[model samples]
Target: MTIDGISSTQGEDGVQEFDVLIIGAGPAGLAAGIYARRAGLSCLILEKGVPGGQVLTSPMIENYPGFPEVPGMKLMDHMAEHARRYVDIREGEEIVRVKGGERFEVSSGAGKYFSRALILTTGSTHRKLGVKGEDGMTGRGVSYCATCDGFFYKTREAIVVGGGNTALTDALYLHSIGCKVSIVHRRDSLRADKHLQESVAERKIPVLFDTVVEEIVGADEVTAVKLRNMKTGVVETKPVNGVFVAVGEVPSNQLA
Candidate 1:
């Protein structure tokens, strides 16, 4: 038997003919495509933005198998390209609505691509600081992962936003790596574990209590952070090479 094309049927009678419509071009989505195509099923990939999803923004990934070290952006591109060799791959499209019945109704920006089954692989988005230029300068200097962007600021000063264990740990890591670290917390009290907090304190990482980053100052890259004393209402500028938003990050599973 031969594989049929996805656009062959109109689905006007509301009957899906294709085997699968994978939403998202992430690792999970592309892996599904490989399996579906190998199983001789018609598969189509629907992606809202550039293919590879949020993984593209990741700086580096060393935990994955085979390759000892690989950039997240490069890995995503390779996955998308490899999946295309087995199935029809499309990009830069979003599924606004999905209706399921005997078949499925997928309404996208480009058009609807119907399939008998669906694989939802839409991933998560990073929880931003909501500060101006923070979203725009992500990956440029503003990062969430100390493992990824830490090496870039070797022997340089960096600022971490948060008072919890993660933020303190990040500060310690940077401090150990010869980088001066500053912890800016929104509240005066730290909520980190006792041991971790003590470790951070022992390191002598400057703790700016009752403080929050009002603004991240930089021209091309991270140059400094505008910190605000929540109690005194005083604003101070601290020189730094990079700013890590350890406040938090949320998965981009809103679509899912």
Candidate 2:
């Protein structure tokens, strides 16, 4: 039997064992670590990217319990710091394989980790629009989550790129949050359900049908979206402070 990417047979560093091995350093993973440590259990957390996951990229958070508004990274930093007092954190280690049993074995590019119990807090990744500047402008002006960034654009213009339920929901939510909200769908009509469609209309959220995002514009933050009107073959730029891509998410479950 092979683990996700590691062979069943042992290799380089053998296996580094712990009472519990938690994969991912997001909020869930960190919280789990805290609990484990509080219970006097030895726990270790492995993270492949930023310790906060997507929260690290979030510019502002409005509804996180205590604070009315806090920087996403700052909140995560506080979590990481608190969790660190109890558990060990390993960042930049990409876990590729996992073998679960009484003794679970996990392998990352860095090394092998073993534990009596394994917790997967592996999060999901937002699907991108693949337009030019989208990658470079991430967290600047291009965002994939409306809920996380909508509050930052109060009374400001923002665009949603998608046609599904999520896209429609984001558009309506942005409008409700005081944004000049609009949606740009590649298809002639939205793929969202009828109820969502009615809500968009009722909310007066503009829909740009048969449109594709050609580029995400901004230098430090999202400034606008360059859109191609498929029907008219016209390209235009819409000024905005935010661009939310509601294209769904891919889970970090390759090892599951």
lDDT of 2 at 153: 82
Ten residues in sequence with the least summed lDDT for candidate 2: 1-10
Candidate 2 lDDT by residue in tens digits, 58-84: 556666999788978899999999988
* Overall lDDT per candidate, in order of appearance: 0.77, 0.82
Which lDDT value does model 2 have at 164? 92
lDDT of 2: 0.82
- Clashes per model (N, Cα, C within 3 A): 6, 5
Considering summed lDDT, which 10 consecutive residues are worst modelled in model 1? 1-10
Off by more than 4 A, model 2: 1-14, 129-159, 162-182, 185-244
TM-scores, one per candidate: 0.61, 0.60
**Model 1: CA > 4 A from native:** 1-10, 13-17, 130-247
